[model samples]
Target: MPERTETSPAHHGHQRSPGREQLETATTVFALLADPTRLHLLWLLAGGEADVTELASESEAARPAVSQHLAKLRLAGLVQARKDGRRMVYSLRDGHLRRLVTEALSHADHQVTGAPWHA
Candidate 1:
């Protein structure tokens, strides 16, 4: 068996199995993502970092709702926020999450629009 490196993919290329903690954490992430409003917020952040105003405006969801959603996502470590003067700027925590949100929405688009799935 090849030695696992920091960048190695889990499972298929090795024998490393997901532990209970990993499984539980992933389930929690999915649970957080189950809400359509939250999913939309994540999808927006995937584009680029933005403040609450921009997110609320673009999402067409109320500003308070956007703030609450961002708070939940931030607590989950899915998204991060930084103070930009008086406004709070928010963005995905890492490339993995960015790709996850993008791919999930893309899959939904395919399902809704009857687009053919790619391999």
Candidate 2:
């Protein structure tokens, strides 16, 4: 076998932690947002905090499904939930996440057509 070198491409200027872990975190976040239901939920939550029933009604998804998606989003740190009496209200955890989602969607729309967002 060839002798391992500290300057090999695999280790060249790489941090102790693998880049793949960061990529995986990003991929997980994107994957959670990829679902149409989840995207709608995020859009609604972007306005303010809402419970599962409200999210389901706004997104046209079943209550249980919306709850499940919210759970995943919470796990990813993209959203937060608080207990209000008998219901759990969810909201965006980071304001930057909201901006990122909006910018990405706008970019995707622009890519599909030549028109850009005026507002």
RMSD of each: 4.2, 8.1
Reference-based lDDT, each prediction:
0.89, 0.82
- lDDT score at residue 84, model 1, on the 0-100 scale: 88
TM for every model, in the order presented, reads 0.86, 0.72
Which lDDT tens digits does candidate 2 get at residues 1-119?
A: 45557855345344455488878987888888888888878888878899999899988899899988998899889999899999998999977678667877777788889786663
Report the lDDT tens digits of candidate 1 across residue range 1-119: 67876656663343567789988998999999999889989998889999999999999999999999999999999999999899899999988777778888889999999999985
Candidate 1's clash total is 0
Alpha-carbon error at 22 in model 2, in Å? 2.9
Point out the worst 10-residue segment of candidate 2 by lDDT: 9-18
Model 2 CA deviation exceeding 4 Å by range = 1-20, 111-114, 117-119
Candidate 1: worst-modelled 10 consecutive residues by lDDT: 6-15
Scored by lDDT, the top model is: 1
